[model samples]
Target: MGGLLSILKGGAKEEEPIDIPLNFGAQPSGPEIEYYNAVAGLMRAAPGILNDLRSYSGCGEAIRQAISNPGKATEDAAWAVVCPAVAKLKDYYDFSCALGNAMGAHAGADQQAPVVSPTEQLFPRILSFLGNGDASQNFEQSQALARKLAEILDFATQFDNLKARSASQPAGQPATMSNPNVQNDFSYYRRTVSRMKMNNAQSVAVVSDEVANKMSLFFAHSNPVTKALIDSANVAVMSRTLSLGGATDVFSILAGVSYHMVAKGRAGNDSAFFLRVMVVSVLLYDHIDPAGAFIKNSKINIKASIKVIQSSGGSGADALLNALRFSTQHLNDETTPKAIKQMLAQ
Candidate 1:
C-alpha cells in the first residue's frame, strides 16, 4: 500500500522525453503498413482497454482504504468495489480469449511465410518461434510447459461436479480430488502462505475487524482482496466450486473445480469463464516470470499456484493451453529473463 505503489507515485525523478517516431516493429513497406495500421487502431482504442486494466484500481484503492481506515463500513466498501470489478474484468478477459483464438487459426493457415497473428502481437516473442521455415529449428522451450497445461485443462473439462447433482456419479469426471480437502485448505497440501499473515474477516471478504487493522501496515503492497482470497481458499468448504474471492487467483483449485461458486462450471457461467482464462494467465505469467521481486517488489504469490497446476493438470487443459500458447506466441517482454535470454539466443 505505502511502499511500492506509493514509490511508483511519489518517487521524484527527472527524465527527458525522446521525440522519436514509434512503430510497432513494422518496416515502412506495404504489408508492414497494413499491420501497423491495425496496431495503430488498437493503440487508439487502448485507452478503453487500459481503463479496463486499471479498473482493478478501484479494488486496489478499496483495499488500501480498508487497511488504513479499518471498520465494517470500510470492509463492506472494499467488497462492493472488488466484486463488481471482477465481474467486469471477466468480460474483458473473454474478449481477449476470442481474439487469441482468431489469431491462432490465421497463423496456422499460412505455412511458408506465416503472417503475424494478433496473438503474436500481444506477445511478440512468439513470432521468433516460426524457425527457419523448418519446424525442427524453432524455439520451443514452452512445449514442455504446454503439454503439462494441456493435461490440466483436459482434466478440468472432463470434471463436472454438477453432474453429481443430476444423478449420483458423473462419467465425465470419475476422478475428483484424491484429497478433496486439499482444495479446502491449499496450504495444508501446497505451501504458498509461508509469509502472508491473515486476520479473519469471517465474512466473504474473509477477514476483517481489529485483526485486519493492526497488521494492515505490514501488508501495504497487497490489498485486502489478496488476503481474503488466500484465506477463503485455505478453508473453503467448496465442491467443484471455490469461494468467489479466489477468482483473484485460482492457484490450482480451478484444475479440480471448474469454476468459483458464490455462492459456479468448467466455465459454466461468467465467473467460471473468467477464472478459466485467469488460471492460464497466471500460469503463463509464472512460467516466464522470475522468482525474484516483481516490478513493485510486490508480495503476490505467482509461482506456488502453477507449481500445483503443473504437478496435477486441470480442465479444458489442452484447449486452454493451446489458445494461450497461440495467443502469446508473438508476445515478447525484455523484462522477463526468459525473453531476454531468448533474444540473446542464436
Candidate 2:
C-alpha cells in the first residue's frame, strides 16, 4: 500500500517551491529595458522641465541666463535632487535654475512629484488681465495652475508621509517594506496622481473669477517680490472675487488707487517694482465695490504711501517714488490726457 501511495504521489515530498532572487545584472528584457529607459528619460527631462517653469514667471534675468548658458543650469538642476535642497536652499546665482527645475518637474508632462512654482501663480494673475478677451484661454490658464498646485501639494503630502513612515520603520527589514502607513501613503499618492492627470486631461475652463482670485492670493504669498506686488495681487484677487459676488466697479477704482499708491507714491529700484504697481492699479480698477465701501483704507494710503513717497535717498523711499513716477506716466497717461499733462507740466 505504501509503494502504491508513493507511485500515486509521483515521488512528491510536498515541499514548498524555493524563491529565486531576481538578478539585475543580466541584460534586461525588452520590458525591463523600456522601464529603465523611461526612468532615464525622466532623469534627462527633469532639468529642462524646470527651466520651462522659470520662463513662465517672466523672470527675464533667469530666463536670459538659462538661454545664454545651458551647461550651468543643467549642473544646478542635477544638484537639486534632495527634497529640501530643491524646496528651499537655492543659491541666488542658481536660484532660477532650481526654481525652473521644480516648476518643470511639477508641471511636466509626467506628473511625478509636483512642486509649487512662483511662475505658476504669476502666470494666471497676468493672464486674467491680459487674455485678449479669451475667456477660454483664461480658464485654461487657471486650470493649469490649479492642476500644478494640486500635484505639488499632493507630492509634499506624500513625501512627508513617506518620510515619517520610513523614519519610524523597524531596522533589518531591508528585503521588504510593507508598513501599513507606507501602503496608505502610496494609495493616497495614487489617488492624487489620478486627480492631477484628470485635471490635465480635462478642459480647464473656469466659469468664475473666484478661482482666479484665490490663485492670485496664493502666488502673492509665495513669490519673492516687492511688498507692493504681494499687496497688489491680494487686492486683485479680492477684487475679482468681490466682483463675482456682485460688487460693481470696485476693482476698477481699486486699480486706479493701487496704481497711484505704488507708481507715483512708493519707492523701489527693482524692475518688478513698476510692474507690480501697474498690476495692482489694473486689478483694483476692474472690480470696484459700492455698497461695502471696501476702498483703500486711510492708514494704508497715509502711513505706507507717505513713508514711501518721502524718501530723498535712493533706497526704499527714493526708489519707490521713482517707480511711481515712471508708472504714473504710463498709467495715468501723463502725455495724452490734457488735464494730467497740464498738471504735470505745471
Candidate 3:
C-alpha cells in the first residue's frame, strides 16, 4: 500500500481523448453499450491494458525478487510493481502503441494509408481483431489456453458434459467449428501420429497450405478443440473444480494475451457475478458463431444457451456457452455481422 502511493506523485501526460468505435450497423444500445463502455478504453488504449496486465503478472515475480532484496519494493515499489529493477525502473519509457491505431486504421506518418493491413489491424493490437485469437481461446480451440483453463476456471468437473456433447456428435456432419474464416485458427491442431495415414488423420489427403482454400464441407472430430478434449477427458475428469477466481481468470487471460497492444477504460467488472457474466458472453457467442466450437454439436437457441448459463436456478447448462461479455472490440468493429452484434448486445 505504501509503495503504490509514490506513483501518485507524478502527473500523467495529457493526450487527445479517444473514441470507442464498436460498429453494429446501427449504434449499439442497452447492454451492448454498457458492455462496449466496459471495454472501449482497453481497446482504444490497449497498451495501457497491457501495462495493467504486466503489473498484475509482475506480482508473482516481484515477490520473488523483493524477497531477495528487502526494502526494494518499499523504496521504489512503483517500478517494482511494473517489474523493472529499481535501478532500471527510472529508465521506464512508454510508447503509446494503440493511440495511432485507435478510432479508424490511422496510419503511421511514415506509412501509406492505402497499404493498411489487408485485414484490419485493430487498435491496441492484442485482439488481432479479425484474427481468431480471442474466439479460439474462449471456445477451447486453442489447445494451450484450454489446458490452462482446465487448471484454473471453475468448470473442470464439467468435462463430462463437454465429452457427452462431443460424443453425441454424429459422424459426417457440419460442426459448429466449420466456418472457413476461423478454420485457419486451428493450424496448430493438424497433426498426424506415427501410424495414422491420411485415412487415420481424418482423410486420405489434407493439404496444409490449401487446407482452407478448399475441402470437404463435412468432418468429424477434425475440429481440434473436440479432438484435443475428447481423448484428454476420456482419460480423466477433474474431481475438483479448479479456479483462479473469476476475476483472476478473466483478467489474467486478457492481460496475458494482449501483447502488442494496450488500451484503457472501464469501471464495472465488479458484478459479484462479473466473471460469470463475462464468461457467459464467451459461451453464448461461441454457440452463436457459425464456427462456435464449444457446443459445436448442439442445435440449441442462443437465448436458451444464455438463459441456461445466466440463471443458475435453471442450471447453467454446460456453462460453456457464455462469453466474458468479452464485450470485446469485436462488437465495436464493422466486420461483425449486424444480427450477431445485436444478439451479443443483449
Candidate 4:
C-alpha cells in the first residue's frame, strides 16, 4: 500500500506542504459542470425510465408471478425490473448533490458546509417523483431496489481467495482443514515466487531449486510430523512453480495458489483465514500500484511487469501503470514521435 502511495506521489515533484483551507462551499469548474450535465441527463430520465420499466412485459409478468412473495419476486427479477429505474434515481440524487456542491463553491462554504447525517439526509430536491408514495411504502421500495442491485453486482466469481488458500498448502499435498500447520506448503511457495522476480530472484530455476533443497532438508530430518509438513508444502509449491516458470507465462503461480486453495474449500476452513485475505491483499496491491520501471537511457523493457499484469486479465492497476510506465520510459525512444506520447498522456 505504501509502495502504491509512493508511485502516485512519484508522478509529481516534491513541493512545500502548504496547508490550504478547504472550502466545501467553493464553486465547481467547467469539468465539474460537464460532470453535472452527464449526471443530470441520467437524472432527468429517471421517471420515464421507471415508467417504462413498470409497463414492460417482463417486469409486469414477473411482478404478477411473484404475488405469492414480493421479497422472492425481487430476487428473481432481472435488472430491467429495477436497475434502469434505481440507476436513474441514483443519478438524480448524484446530480442534486453535485449541484449542491457547485452552490457551496459559490458560497465559499467549502469546509464549513454542514455534513448531513445518514438519517437526517433529506431526499434530493429533484426526486419529488418518489414523494407520491407513502413513506413506509417508499422506504420498502428503496430497500428492495437496493437489495436487488446488490444481487446483480455481486461478483460471484471466486478467483483470488481460492488461489491464495491452495497456495498456502504445501504443493502436491491436498490441504485438509483438520491439519493447521502444513509447513512450507504451496502458499509459502507462492509468496516466495512472487517475491523472487519483484526483488530479482536470481533466476526462476534457482528459486525452484531452493524449494527442492529446502524440501530435501525437511525430509532428511527425524521428526515425522516435520517431514510430512515440509513434504506437503514442497508438493504444493512445485505444482505452481512448474506451470508459471515459462518466459511468456506472466501469471504468478504463487498468486494462483490462493485461487486453487479456495476452490479446494481449504480457504474458509483455515483457522486464521490469513491465506484468504492475503490473496485479496495481493490483488489490492496490484490494483493501485504502478508497474515499477527499470529505465536506463533509451532502452525500455516493460516485459516483466506488463506480462505479470496481462496474465492476470489486464484490468488491474498494475496493467494501467505498466502502460503508463512504458509510455513514460520510451517517450523519447528514437523511433517514436513526441506527438504519440502526448496523445497517450491525454
- TM-scores, all candidates, are 0.22, 0.22, 0.20, 0.15
The segments of candidate 2 whose C-alpha lies over 4 angstroms from its true place after superposition are 1-85, 89-241, 244-283, 286-308, 311-315, 325-346
Could you tell me the lDDT of residue 326 within candidate 1?
29
Q: Per-residue CA lDDT of candidate 3, range 44-99, in tens? A: 43334334323322233434343467563542442223323211211111111121
lDDT against true structure, model 3? 0.27
Q: Compared with the true structure, what per-residue lDDT tens digits does model 4 show for residues 125-176?
A: 2122122223222222343321121111111011111111232443222222
What are the per-residue Cα lDDT tens digits for candidate 1 across 179-297?
12212122111111222234422334223332222222212211111222222222221221332222212222222222222112222343434334344434332332233111222
**What's the lDDT of the predicted structure labeled candidate 2?**
0.29
Q: Once model 3 is optimally superposed onto the true structure by TM-score, how far is the C-alpha of residue 13 displaced, in angstroms?
A: 55
Q: What is the C-alpha lDDT profile of model 2 across 1-346, one tens digit per residue?
A: 3332232123123211111111212443332343333333333433443443333222223333433665656423422222222122122112322212323222323444334344423322432332224322222333333222222222222222222223444321221232332233223323333554676844222212332232232222212222223233334345462222221122222222333434453323432333233233322222122221112221112123323334322333432333333322232432233432333231
Q: How many backbone clashes does candidate 2 have?
A: 28
Candidates' lDDT values, in order? 0.29, 0.29, 0.27, 0.28
Root-mean-square deviation per candidate: 23.9, 30.2, 26.2, 28.2
* Candidate with the larger lDDT of 2 and 4: 2
